[model samples]
Target: MTISIDATHLADVTDFLQGCEKVVGSPNVLTNAADKSAFLTDQRQRFTGAAIAVVKPGNTAEVAAIVKLCNQFKVPLVPQGGNTGLVLGSVPDSRGNAIVLSLARLNQVRAIDPINHTITVEAGCILQNVQEAAFAADRLLPLSLAAEGSCTIGGNLATNAGGTAVLRYGNTRELCLGLEVVTAQGDIMHGLRGLRKDNTGYDLRDLFIGAEGTLGIITAAVMKIFPLPKAQLTALVALQTPDQALQLLTLAQGRCGAALTGFELMSDLCLQLVAKHMPQLTFPFSAHYPYYVLMEISDSESEAHASNLLEAVLAMALEEDICQDAVLATSSAQSKTLWQLRESISSAQAKEGKNIKHDVSIPISRIAEFISVTDGLLQQQFPGCRNVTFGHLGDGNLHYNVSPAIGASVEAFLDQQTAINLVVHDSVHAFGGSISAEHGIGSLKREELLRYKSAVEMQLMRTIKQALDPLNLMNPGKVI
Candidate 1:
């Protein structure tokens, strides 16, 4: 007997879920609101949308089946992985009409080719775990970030994440060799060959890699690995301003060339926050400066040589007044400690107050000018404000964040976020910078992206959005 019922009622959705779960088994589908709340909310709680049910598909076929059913029922889908995204991309909307399709159970390492140096992994695999697997294989999966512990490979690929290794190993987009996706109509596009040279027509791999789930659902990926850098050196430099940091970056590259893998800038206000929040660090610099840079240099077998080269660069930078002082990590432990100070800025800022964060980028040559211009404009506009400047300066990206004046309530201060972001992002525009650097244009910057992106770019993105997701079932109300 064929049974039919209403689609909007909770019982109707639950009934539909029961039928969907029959294809996979009993443990993968959920309908209870309390149980699904965790999946509906984002990591930062900034975006919490409603979900009628949460579905966990364990494999490619299962994901396709779920998508087909959702399409037929007109239930919007939200594809989620580790829930680590910051811009409301993975979460549902306030409408509560969508359901999250969790990909965690799809976790698997299908194969590892140590010679060709690639690892095929399911989208649900945690990033750090993938790195560990590569490490065990005596190779390196160089894409890395602080959230590696929890963020999924799918999330990183979906956003085309750029982490600490971008200087040496480009972003996640460069590291990925191929992808396996579940189309909107439940067709499996199994583009899962580890081919090194395939000039095969349209590179579909690139489309799904950074589509943010607007085009299709990614189930797994083939990631490129590398022979590990045999030697590495990390150091922290003290600078008086953004200009000094910029000069120090130039000196390091000129001195070490390709060996320079990382160059991150920080601020005194950031350090103060670290010391105030995370006490493990003792502040290595002799004195505090307005700006700082923490960087790493790596080579095939030149660990000691790289250390010496960094010291030589530091000397020249100091003499040239590009840096005030410096501290080179002598041991791995000390290097990690130095990194802790740099990495703790985000957490410390969260504790301080509502920080208006701008993960922006400008021309590599115009970083210093962008900082100076934006700093002056911000200070003049929001007097008595604390502007904390820093980021991966080597890659033309900066986390130009600002905290409210001391003791200001977040309730009142947040109202001006729009006006403040306008001034800051406008300066970024004047410098020919991207409003959304590596963070991807999630709902947070959806409007801001429009302000910076040209009409032609927006039109192209919309065309792609319409082409791949004509029915708009794949993570609707996000990106384009």
Candidate 2:
């Protein structure tokens, strides 16, 4: 929590701001208290930082020039994209000596090639706009997330974000084919290639994709796109247990195969929270079950075909008693309503009370056991703790969260964060699962990473950080 601002560095902050102003007009370079506040806090408000100035560079060249001047003045610069990250990775540090480099002005769709199934876009472009552009081109950029409207492509790539569709299209790493990055020392690496087969010396694109802006600043990228699905089927099913839900998932994948795009699972507790917070949205089922799943399948076929396919899967699931009740969307309006129920889980949890969130992943086969065992242990250890389990079941990732009991205060429940994390993360490690499934190791999980990662892995990360940014000025004190 200690933030140190060297006195000598303070003397040079003004000159650094002036240099940035020359590259991108003084108006774009903000030093006022009000203008800098937006870039100081993260989306989750977990950490509030202080920056000397916030600079908005319009293009890659401007970003290069600003980075070059920061290197010369020995001033650390934090590359910010939309500021929609759950972890505090996109925000400036509390040192009050760094500059928050905003990429919002760099929003632009550079190119879209439907033939090659690739879309090259600037880093600052909103994710929703990128998706819409692909749709306009008769293509699909399947990186759908809740924050698509506000989050930028650069932040998504930086964290290697995984949304509900990761089961089908993979994370940002697999979506990106090329990148244009600016080195820590200010040299621009123009590597935006849409080619699918490139056996180059080194895959530098990957080095910056999930590096969280510690290695370099990403300006633009060439991402893989796909043909838009002609039809999609959506369903909401009620299950008695996680075991039954896993059985249903396996059965659906066997029947639907590649057409199965999304398979999400949630607890009745999650549904109750959603119902309590969002009364306008109606649940598809008449009665609530212990567990629920909102699944979707898409294909290049007619709506009737999609509906028939979903019907067959549901019929088989019912025959096997894997699901207690089920409801398939008959119209696009109903499909959206089913999705609303699934998407409202997070927001409703927020409305309920303070909750501790754990985004972890285990093998698909062990997921049910992990959930049941973890729930039992948590309830036994911390009496009256409410467990909210849900996530992309097809990919084996779960957002296992905990909220305080009805009478308990949020502060008292949060006091057990350390104990809760240890127990939950320990179980995940024992199952050979990851502590951080989607979110990166920002300051929040840096210590956890050190405790779990091997010495060789940590050393290799440090070696790469040292090579890319020898001065350690590029997002200093993050990741490595």
**Local accuracy by lDDT, each model:** 0.85, 0.89
lDDT of 2 by residue, 1-480 (tens): 222456545446667778888999999989888988989998887788988788999999999999899878888889989888776788877878788889999899999999999999999999999999999999999998889999899999999999989988889999999999999999999999998789968888888988889999999999999998989889999999989988998898898888999999999999999899999999777787999999999977888888889999999999989998999988889999999988999999998877999989899899999998998899899989999999999899899998888898889789989999999999999888998888787767888888788899999999999999998878877777
Say which candidate scores most in TM-score: 2
Candidate 1 residue-wise lDDT, 161-223, digit = tens: 998878778889889888899998889999888887899699999988778998999999999
Candidate 1 local lDDT, residue 113: 96
User: Among all windows of ten consecutive residues in candidate 1, which has the lowest summed lDDT?
Assistant: 1-10
**What's the TM for model 2?**
0.98
Poorest stretch of ten by lDDT in candidate 2? 1-10
TM-scores, all models, native as reference: 0.96, 0.98
Model 2, residue 390: C-alpha shift (Å): 0.9
